[model samples]
Target: MMADLREMYTFEFMRYALTVGVFGGGMLAFLGIFVHLRRIVFLGAALPQITALGIALAIALHLPLLVGAVLGGLVGILLLSTSGKPGHLPTEGWVGLAYASGGSLAIVVLALSPHPDAGALRFFTGDVLGTNRAEALFAIAVAGFTALIFRLCWSKFVVSSFDPVMSQTLGLKVRRWNALLFLCLGFGLAAVMNSAGSMLAFGMLIGPPAAALMCFRAFPKVVVTTVVLGAGAAFVGLTASFLFDLPGGPTMATAALAPVLPAWIYRKIRK
Candidate 1:
């Protein structure tokens, strides 16, 4: 098995896929902690769909797909944030609405396009194995940016998430912090959805963090464990896909669940 794995990485495409999966998976898992802790898992599901819609639109308009994706994700984030306030549509409702709308819009856009299969549509579902060096670099850059933001505002983000009132009491701009966090989430989703597809990206965003929460209570430990598990899942899943000739994105997503189920069951039994 080790020999096969080593031989597989001899190819440039395999190396690129592995690099993307590791960095992209780690970034998704790191951001997922906020989604899980804030009880906003729906965003994990919704934003990616919105980004897919953007990719479809970009294809139709002959624009850069990444630009379309980021714009679409940002629009979704803005809409959700605006309507998600108290005395408005609840966050889950907004997220559900966005998900459905985005999926429908993507289908409509593709159906109306002159060339539906212009190859960009693969991003909607994912094409992780097709990732090139440039996309991998973009993924790395986004991950680095996310890490910097988290490092600088770690306490503010945690405080804003756990206690908005406390954040305000401490003279923090709660809304600003929340917006920054959501922006980072949107950026990460857009960056990965192109390579990993919306579905796999969403899985990475939720699965590892969920598993980590089951295994640890300390915030730092949970964050570190989530990153490790996500990266590991991506690596294993990519290897399996190469060996079995399976779809890379879904394989990785399914692999991410491997550790989660056992950890969840253990936590339940302990409880």
Candidate 2:
């Protein structure tokens, strides 16, 4: 059974896949807790596809795709800034328009760009089995950043998460903190993009924390369970991708959903 998925690492891309599965899983597992709790999972959710547009544009224009993605994320942040929610800069209506525009812009760019190929397909589809040493190092850096932030600002983030007004009243720069959190999520989204591609990246952003929150009894448990589920999903998904010769990123994402779906269905049934 295991031989069906014997990884052939003679090719470089396969290493990148597994590398991403491990390191990307680590970073995202940590980040998922915040996005899940804050209900802003969509930053991870929507931005990667938008980033793909930027990458496609860069391809056509002969620029670096990664730089294009960072630019795209910056554009997303700019759009969000104008989104009003109380102290938020943009109104709900404005945010909706922003999302619509972002998605539409990506489609237009893809349609206009030249030289679309499997290479480009990797962006939307994911290439988990293709992990390389450099990408793995990148993943480690992202994971390190996430861990550092979580350790240094866990309490502040938690207070703001559950009760923002009180957190602010205590002299925390509430608005600035929220913006910083979103920025972290954006950086995270960009970092994890290659590991899981678009939707898989979105799944990593949402799945583990969601599963942990549902299964665990306490906040601390949420953290532990989230990381565990994230790693488990990545391992299982990568294995599945190997067996089926499927795209690693989406397979990992679909596998990530495996735990969540049954739990969600069970919750609904019990209700």
Candidate 3:
């Protein structure tokens, strides 16, 4: 098994894919804690579709995929963040619209692109094994930056997130913190969606943190466990996919979600 593993990673592409899987999965899982805490899981789902739309637009316009993804994610954040205000449609309604339209539009735009790349389908279907060195490095950089920011502003972020009114009373700049958090979410989603596709991006964002939160109440332990599970799922899923000749992205997503049921059962038993 060890020799086979070594042989599999002897190719640079496999190493690059693994790097993206680990770092991208870990980062999305970490950010997912905030998504869960804020009860914005729908928003998380919508953003990936929006990011895909951006990728399709970039392909159509011959722009950078990262640039399009970032813009698309940010636009989704801006639109969805303000949707909680009193309106005819509930926030969920608007989020659902974005989710539906964004995905449909991406496919339409991609279909219309005059210069579509042969691998363009991979953007939606996922092609993690095709990841390049630059994409792997970008994943690492984004993950490191996210960790560093949260490390420096842990208390502020936590306080602002869970208790906005109290955060305002304490003059913690709640709005600024919230915006920063959304910015990080948008950036991270864009990066992950660009490389791993929307399925892996959304799966990693929701799965590990959901399981970790089910098992533990301590934020620090939850964070650690979530990252570990996410990265471990990526490794396990990629290896399984390789060995079984299955699809890599969906395999990783399934692995990421595998812990949820066990954790839920554990919680029920403890209670």
Candidate 4:
């Protein structure tokens, strides 16, 4: 179990890759609680595609790729929160539009190139084994930011999640918090996409959190459980990919799903 990871740590690139995956896993697990509670599952796919379009546009314009991804995700976030208002469509419809348009743009841009697979893999699946030291430092910073956000809104976010109306009655500014949640989610989404690629980020964002919530009964317990499950999955997936010559993103998702299996089986037996 530890051999692959130990070997991975000896190399500078693999060390960073594992570091990024760990921080990325923790961050996603943290934010995913809010995402799931808010009933915003589609944000996983929508935000990533929007960032992918940003990457494509950056390639087209020769600007900073990360900037394009962040800006694109922010635009999508704005549309998600404010679209279909003032005599326009609904937020759901707006999200659908952005999802399609951004994903389409990315696909088109990638297809126009001579070799699309490598580019697609790098942008969507992530190169976890080849991550650099700088990227690892960036991941740590992002993880710290995630921790800060969670600390600031620990109580309010929990109250709002369980009962928005009661929170509002208590002068909790639920709407403002919800908006702020979306903004933090936007930043989290952007950060993970750059570090882990869209698919790994999306899976790690939802999968381990979902699994942990299914296992734990209390809020604080759920947070610890989710983070543990998420980081564990990342470690397992990284090792599996390295040993089996598998891709990083899908393997990480598979590892995440591993923890959910026992619960699912028990549910089936009870049913």
Candidate 5:
């Protein structure tokens, strides 16, 4: 078993895949804390679909995939954030619209691509094994940058996120902080969705954090446990995919979500 596990990394592709899984998955999980705390879980769902639409457009137009993904995610965040006007369809209404249209349009656009590559559709279905070193490095860079920013401005983020009114009273730029948080979310989602697919990216965003919040009430512990679980899920899912010849992205998604049940059970029992 040990030899088999060690041999998995001997292959270059596997190394890249693992690196992406660990860093990207962990980052998404970390951002998920804010998603949950801010009560914008639906926004989390919507962004990935929108990001997928971006990838499809990129493929159809022969643009760079990463460019498409980042732009798409950023656009989605910007549009959604500015929504919820006095008489508009409400923020959730817009989120639902984006969530519904983004996924469907992605497929339609792909179908209409004049020259679709066979591997292009992997953006939706996921193709972690196809991840290259550059993408892996991108994942690491994004994760590291996210961590650094959050670390330096932890108080401002927490204040702005948990109590925007109070944050404003304190003379902090709440909107800027909110924008920065969403920017991080956009970049992190695009990076993960680029290689791991929207499904795994969303799973990592919601799952480990959900589970960790269930198990712990302390903020720091919740964050640490969430990151650990995210990374662990990636390792387990990749190993399982290798041994069982399963699809890498969905398998990792399943692993990321697996902790929810146990954590919920523990919460119930403790209650």
Candidate 6:
């Protein structure tokens, strides 16, 4: 088994997939902490579907799929930002609408393609092993940019998320900061979905953070733990996919859930 694993990395595609799985998983897990904390987990589901629709449209238009996915996700975030305001639809309603609309549009667009089934399957399951250097570099760039923004504005983000009233009292530009955070979230979602597809993106975004929250009380510790566990799951899942000839995205997503189930069970028993 060890020999097989070592030999797998000898292939560039395997290496690229592993690189994406690790870094992309960590990035998703990091942003996921904020998503869970803010009680807006629906973004995880909605944004990825939007991204998928974007990829589908890109395929139909013969454009760059990543660009389409990013644009779609950003548009979804913008619409979601207006949700829950007075006279506006609630966040949940917006998320549901986005998910439904995106999925439907993707299906319709893909049906017009020459190989609709293949395109549809790739959108649903992803092709992590088929990842190239360009996609990996793009993922790295997105992750790095997101980390820099969070590092510089960590305190402000925390204040806005945890205590919006206090943020208003402090004269913080709360709406602007929130918009920035949403932008970061949308970009990160697009990058990850490009490699891991929508389902796996949603899974990594929620599972590791939720599990870490169950095990740790401190915010910093939770962040660290979530990154470690998420990356580890990606590694394991990628390896398993190679060994078992399984789909990388779903396998990785399931691996992410592995820790979550045990953590949830333990927390429930203790409570």
Best by TM-score: 5
**Top of the candidates by lDDT:** 5
1 versus 5: better lDDT goes to = 5
Question: How well is each residue in 167-259 modelled by candidate 5, as lDDT tens digits?
Answer: 899899999999999999999999999998999999999999999999999999999999999999999999999999999999999999999
Q: Per-residue error at 114 for model 6, in Å?
A: 7.1
lDDT of 2 by residue, 120-168 (tens): 5566667655445655677777677777887898888788878988887
lDDT score, residue 119, model 4? 43
TM-score of each: 0.95, 0.84, 0.97, 0.87, 0.99, 0.94
Query: Which residue runs of candidate 4 sit more than 4 Å off their true CA positions?
Result: 1-4, 84-88, 111-121, 267-271
Prediction 2 global C-alpha lDDT:
0.68
Residue lDDT tens for model 6, 1-271: 8898899999998988888888888889888999999998877788888888888877777777788778888988987777777677876888899889887888787888654434444657766776778778877888888888888989999998899999999999899889988888888788778777887788889999999999888988998899998899889999999899899889998898789889988889988
Q: What overall lDDT, based on C-alpha atoms, would model 6 receive against the true structure?
A: 0.84
Write the number of the candidate with greater TM-score, choosing between 2 and 3: 3
Clashing pairs in 3: none
lDDT of 3 by residue, 146-260 (tens): 8999999999999999999988998899989899899989988887788779999999999999999999999889999999999999999899989999888888889999999
Residue 200 displacement in candidate 6 (angstroms): 0.8
TM-score of candidate 6 relative to the true fold: 0.94
Q: What's the residue-level lDDT of 176 in candidate 5?
A: 100
Q: RMSD in angstroms, all models?
A: 1.5, 3.1, 1.0, 2.8, 0.7, 1.8
Ranking by TM-score: 5, 3, 1, 6, 4, 2
Q: What tens digits encode model 4's per-residue C-alpha lDDT throughout 61-163?
A: 6665567667877777776776667667766777788889888888687667454344444756676665667667767786887688778878887888779
Whichever of 4 and 5 has more lDDT, that candidate is 5
Model 1 CA lDDT for position 257: 71
In angstroms, the error of model 3 at 212 is: 0.5
Model 4 worst lDDT window (10 residues): 113-122
Considering lDDT, where higher is better, how would the candidates rank from best to worst?
Answer: 5, 3, 1, 6, 4, 2
**Cα-based lDDT for every prediction:** 0.86, 0.68, 0.91, 0.74, 0.94, 0.84
Error of 3 at 73 (Å): 1.3
